[model samples]
Target: MTDFITRFAPSPTGPLHLGHAYSAMLCHDMARTAQGRFLLRMEDTDLQRSKPEWDALIREDLTWLGLHWDAPVLRQSEQISSYDLYLDQLAEHDLLYPCSCSRADIRAALSAPQEGHPHEVYPGTCKARPISDRNQGDALRLHLDRALVMLADDLPSFQETGGTHKGTHQIDPDQAQEQIGDVVLTRKGERMIAYFLASAIDDATQGITHVIRGEDLFDFTAIQVILLTLLNLSVPTYHHHRLIRDENGKRLAKRDDARAISTYRNDGRTPSDIRRMVGL
Candidate 1:
């Protein structure tokens, strides 16, 4: 049997709030229950916002919460070359194209009201651009239509153990083409990769069997699964747990310093108190 390996990946852009505490503690408890490995990863691909001090503070807060992760923590910043290799493979398949469209440009092109659409789907302005035409500051977007056709024989799907949309769910080609058209895999300047791409590659490379995260990210799981299938990597089971919200019923953000774990610790809150607060 494969070991139940899970990970708690957090961006070092801000302080660890109650929301982060809930996710980390949940992952830690589950790993311990299964007697499996719980790994820590720093999702610091956004180099502009990611800071060394915040990274140190994150480790400190996790330790203070009595949540220990298996060592040596993985940092996405160190895996740029690895991510590039995967991008290269996707490029070779002719499934990626350079996109130089800015937000204003996209909005201008999409002037027609896209009512009932939850997200602003890219209009694929650069879909016809060849890979050879990629510039230094251009972003790379996936040709979802072409990729789906490539996987026409066997579409990508995943198993969800938790969340509102639990059970087996398959990626519908029609819905994907409409809702998730030509999603960006690499940001402009090509210095950073998209979260979907990086996380998908990391989960596969680390051999994570179970992905435990917040329910808010559940919607984006399909794109990750698609990328995994395209890369011929193993897809892990997903468990999207409920988020820890503030008293106002709003989801806690990094700016919510009052609900930060560090604040609670400084106010003399115990780990057990935290577990109770998060309904663990």
Candidate 2:
């Protein structure tokens, strides 16, 4: 087998849809074709919404679609301690700060809608505030300005192989501030680890050489790249594929049961049908 390793990670919050199948199949086929390892990860960090049943359903759907993942699926819920360790390292470097801003607070602060991303680009509202003034319910946010300054001379670059955005890209100081602002590292909940934080750590630790995901996440790749650079971890090549959209040209959501793999299976759809639908 080659040294190339890839993963198909899905959150256990809903049924496996066509979009999820496409992503999983793409990752699986890539690894199989290159004689590399394909790993499965369950991103069940949302304690309130994640369910074991959904995890089981995901496995069944993947199996029904004739997909195979490496043994011993990794669950994000089991890696909180590891995430906390990295969080501590960032804190020691003074690149993290407490954020007590509520959703309403953020919405009120940003008068205009955030371009290219769904969530509002954080305005670094609580960055200058003292960490001692942090409340128990407060979440942690990355100080992008301070982080960039810390890595002033040693900023890292990443390679992309997918879509029109393919190339070696460097972190633009101006773009980082304007487009990707101070992102939250932790949230005010049981599972404090944010998606970017956990994903960066997992990709590095698991030795993932290539990251394959939808183009919708293209904008957020910079955030993960920054985190990996700060943590002194290896950055992998990225391949951002096209997303599966609905009739309205909207990306398929988890709640869209009509487009779900389970529904297709019930309607006598074969694995080949799935591959054909997703243009495999």
Query: lDDT tens digits, residues 45-127, model 2?
Result: 66667799999999999988888877689998877767888888988888888887885543222211122346567876788
TM-score of candidate 1 on Cα atoms, chains taken together: 0.93
**lDDT (10s digit) by residue, model 1, range 133-246:** 988877888999999999999998999998687899999999888777888777555476787688889999999999999987787788889999999999999999998887
- How does each model score on TM-score? 0.93, 0.93
**Predicted structure 2: clash tally:** 0
Q: In terms of lDDT, which candidate is strongest? A: 1
Q: Which portions of model 2 show Cα errors greater than 4 Å?
A: 103-117
Give Cα distance to truth, residue 179, candidate 1, Å.
1.7
lDDT over C-alpha atoms for residue 45 of model 2: 69
Each prediction's whole-model lDDT (CA) = 0.85, 0.82
